[model samples]
Target: MSEHRPVETWLTDMDGVLVHEEQAIPGAADFVQALQASGKRFLVLTNNSIFTPRDLRARLLASGIDVPEDALWTSALATAQFLADQRGGGSAYVVGEAGLLTAMHDIGFVMTERDPDYVVLGETRTYSFESITRAIRLIEKGARFIATNPDPSGPSPFGTLPATGSVAALISTATGRQPYYVGKPNPLMMRSALNRLDAHSETTIMVGDRMDTDIISGLEAGLRTVLVLTGSTRREQVETFPYRPSRIVDSVADLIRFVDHGKPATH
Candidate 1:
C-alpha cells in the first residue's frame, strides 16, 4: 500500500474500542486523553441510539473514560440530522428512547400519532407492542420509515436482545416499507460526522472493532480504517471479508504512539 497523509483527525467506535459492557477497555482512557492533549479533532461513534450523548458521557465517565459530551456521535443524532436536512421541522411518531426523542424535539419535530410525516425507529430496551402497532399503522397511512442502524441484536448480561433492526424488520413485514438507516455501515453517518467536524476524509482515520460496519462505512466514506481485535471481529475473521481495513491491531493501546507521533502503529 502507498503512503497517505498524516492523520489529523480521528473517529473511533465506542463499544469495542473504548468500553465493553460499561467497563473501559484497557488503555482506552489513555487513548482518549492523548487525543485531547494533542488537540486532535475526534469523535466517538456508536450505533446504539438508546441514550443521549450526555447520558453516554456520564456512563463512560463512571467507567473511567472521560469523553466530552459533544464529542460523542450517536445514531440518534444522525437520524435527527438527516430528518432535519431532508424536511425541516416535521412531525414524527418516534419509537425510541430519550436519545432519539430529545434529538427529534431539538430539531423542532412534533411527536404525534396523528398523521406524522415519518415513523422513526431507534434503539431501546423497552419496546412496547402498542407503540409498534401505532408505528405500523402510521406507516401504512403514508409516513416514511427511518431506522437508526441495521444491527439485529444487542448485547446484554442475560443474552442477545432484539435491537432496532429486528424491530424495524417487524414493522417492514407489517407495512411492506423498508426504512432508510442513518447509522454505521451507511456512509451517511460518517459523512455527517465529517461535516460536523469540518474534517476531510483524506486526513482522517476511522478506528473500529467491527469490520462489517465500521470498516466498510469508513472505506465507503473515503477514510482510512483500522480494525482492532478488542471487539467483535477476531483476527481470523479478517480473511473472510472481501474488503480489508488499512491496518489491524490488537487493541487501542497499540495506536497511542501513532496518535502522538503521526507514525503508523506496528501491525
Candidate 2:
C-alpha cells in the first residue's frame, strides 16, 4: 500500500469498529479520547437507523465509551438530510422507529400516508406487514422510494433478524421500484458526514470493519481507509475484495500509537 497523507479528520463505523454485541471493543474508548484530546474533528458512523444519537450515546456510555451525541451520526440522519436537500419540507410515508421518525421530524418533514411524496423505509425490530403493505401501495401510486441502509440482517442475542435491506428487497419486488439506499457503501453518506464535520476527504481517514460498506464507501468518496479486524470483516476476507484499505490492523488498539505519533505507519 502507498503512504497516506497526514490524517486531519476521522470517520469511524460504530458497531464493529467501536463496539460489538453491545460491548465496547478494547482501546475503543482510548482511541476516541485521543481524538478528542488532539482536537481532531471526528464522527462515529452507523448504518443502523434504529436509535437517535442521544439514545446511541447513552448506550455507548453504558459500555464505557463517552462519545457525545453530536459526534454520532446515523443513516437515519443521512436519509433525512438527503430528503431535506432533495425536496425541502416534503411529506413521507415512513416505516421505522423513533430514530427514523425523529430525524425526519428534525428536518421538518411531515410524516403521513395520504399521498406522500416518498415512501421511506428504515430499520425496525418489529416490521408491521400492514405498514409495509401501505408503503408498497404508496410506491405503486408513484411515491418515490427511499431506504436508510442496505443491511440484510442485524445481530441480536436471539439471532440475526431481517433489516432494512431485506425489507427494501421485498418492497422492490412488489413495486418494481428499488429504494435509494442512503447509508454506508453509498458515497453520499460519507460526503454528507464530511460535510457535517467540515472536513476534506484528502485529510480524512475512514476506519471501519466491513470492506463492502466502510472501506468501499471511503474509497469512493476519496478518503483513505483502515480495516480493523475487530468488527464484521475478518483479515482473510479482506483479500477477497477488489481493492485494499490503506492499512489493516489487529484492532483499534493497534492504531492508538499512530494517532499519538501524528500519521499512519507506512505500509
Candidate 3:
C-alpha cells in the first residue's frame, strides 16, 4: 500500500457489513473491538428504521457484536434530525414502528395525521393498508412526504418483504407527491451521521456490502468507501456500476488489521 490518510472515524452498514440475517460476519466482532480499543470514533449505520438504537444494540449483542447504543445511527434518527433542523418542533403523520416514533418524539415532533407538516414513511414488518391510506389522504391534503430509505424491499427470516420505499411509491402514485428519502443513497444521511460523530469526511471511511447505497453516499459525502463482498452485492455485480470503492475486501474481517493499525486499505 502506498502512502494514504489514516482513518480516524468509521461508518459501517449494519446488515451486510457486520451481520447477515442475525449472524455476525466473520471478523466483524474483531473489527468493532479493534475500533473500540483504539478509541476511534465510529458508528454503525443502518437504513432499517424499524429498531431503536437500544433495540439494535441488544440484537447485535446477541449476535456476538457489542456496540454501544449511542454508536448506532439509523434512518429514523436522521429523518428526525433533519426535520428538527428544517423546522423545529414540527408535526408529522408517521407510518412506522417504535423506532421511527421514538425518534420523532425525541426531537419534539408531534405525531398527527391531520394537517401534518410531513407524511413520514418508514420500515415496518406489518404495513397496514389503513395507516398507508391515511398517509395518502394526508399527502393529498398537501402534506409533504418523507421516507426513511429508498430500498424497495428488505431481507427477513421469511423472505424479502416490502420496505419503506415500496410503500412510499404507492403513496406517491396515489397522491402525486414524491417522498424526500432521508436514508442511504442520500448524502444528507451521511452528513447527518458525520455531524453526530463530529467527524470530518477526509478522515472517515465507510464500509458496506451494497454498492448503490453505502458506496455512493460515502463518495458524495467526501469519505473513502470500501465494499465488502459478504452480503447483497457480489464481486461481479460491482463492475456493473460506473463508480468504484476505494478498496474491495472479502468481508469486514479482511479490514480488521487496517482498522486496528489506523491505516487505509489498498485497492
Candidate 4:
C-alpha cells in the first residue's frame, strides 16, 4: 500500500529560488539546515544547463549552500538521460558548451561528426552565427532535435539574454521542425527526475521562482508546487495568470513557515 500523502522530500530550484544572481538568499542556508535537521531529503533543480552538477555544487558551496552533486539535477543532465533512455547510446551533434557535452557524454551519449543522430542545444556564452548555422543544418538533415530548456531569455545581473527559446526559434525558422524541450513546462525532465530520485509525484513539491515553467510543470506532473516570489515572478503578474500555485511565499526563507501553515497530510 502507498500513502498518497506529502512527505519530507523537497525538490527545489537553484538559480532564482535560492540565490539572487550569485549571492545566497537571506536565511536560505538556515532554512536548508532546518530542513536537514528534520531528516528530510532535498534536491536542487535548475533549468540552466550551463553548469554541471559538480560546477553548480561548487558554486553553491562557495555561496554557503553546501550541496552535493547527488543532490543536484540540471536540465542538461535530464536532457541527456531522457535521450539515452529513449534512443540509447546514439551519437548527437551538440551546440552547447562543456557542461552540456559533459552531461550527455556521462550519460552514455556520444557527440559525433556532423549529421549525427540528434541535435542537442543548450546554453553557450559564445553563441554566434556559425553555431546557430551548424545546429540549423543538422536539424534540416532530419536529425532528432532537442533543447535543454525553452526559457525565452537568461537571467543576468542587469536583465535578460538569449536563452534556449531564442536559439530554438532560429532553428525552427530554418528547418520548420520544432526542437523537443526537456526542461520545465515539459514532462521529460520531471518524469526523468522522478525515476532518478525514485520519488513519488504525490509527495514532490517543485519549488521555483517562475510560474509558467516551474509551477506549471509541477502541476502537470501531479505534484504539489510552491512559488517563491524572490525572482522572476511578481505578485501583480500572478493575479492575471489562470493557474495558481499550491502555496506561495516571499522566499525560500519562509518555506518552513509555509509548511507549518499547510494542510495536514499523511505518508
**All candidates' TM-scores?**
0.98, 0.97, 0.97, 0.92
Ranked by lDDT, the better of candidates 3 and 4 is 3
On residues 166-232, what C-alpha lDDT tens digit does candidate 2 reach at each position?
9999999988999999999999999999999999999899999999999999999999888898888
The lDDT of each candidate is 0.94, 0.92, 0.92, 0.80
Ranking by lDDT: 1, 2, 3, 4
Q: Which parts of model 1 are misplaced by more than 4 Å?
A: none
Alpha carbon lDDT at 163, candidate 4: 87
Best by TM-score: 1
Model 2 misplacement above 4 A: 1-4
Clashing residue pairs, backbone N/CA/C < 3 A, model 3: none
lDDT by residue for model 4 (4-90), tens: 474656778887788878799987787667666766667788888888888888888888987768888889988888888888989
lDDT of 2: 0.92
Candidate 4: Cα lDDT at 115: 67
**Model 1: how far residue 262 lies from native, Å:** 3.0
Indicate the residue-level lDDT of 100 in model 3: 96
| Candidate 1 per-residue lDDT over residues 1-267, each given as its tens digit | 248777889999999999999989999999999999999899999999999999999999999999999999999999999999999989999999999999999999999999999999998999999999999999999999999999999999999999999999999999899999999999999999999999999989999999999999999999999999999999999999999999999999888988866555657
| Clash number for candidate 1 | 0
Report the poorest 10 consecutive residues by lDDT, candidate 2: 258-267
lDDT of 2 at 120: 92
Clashes of 4: 0
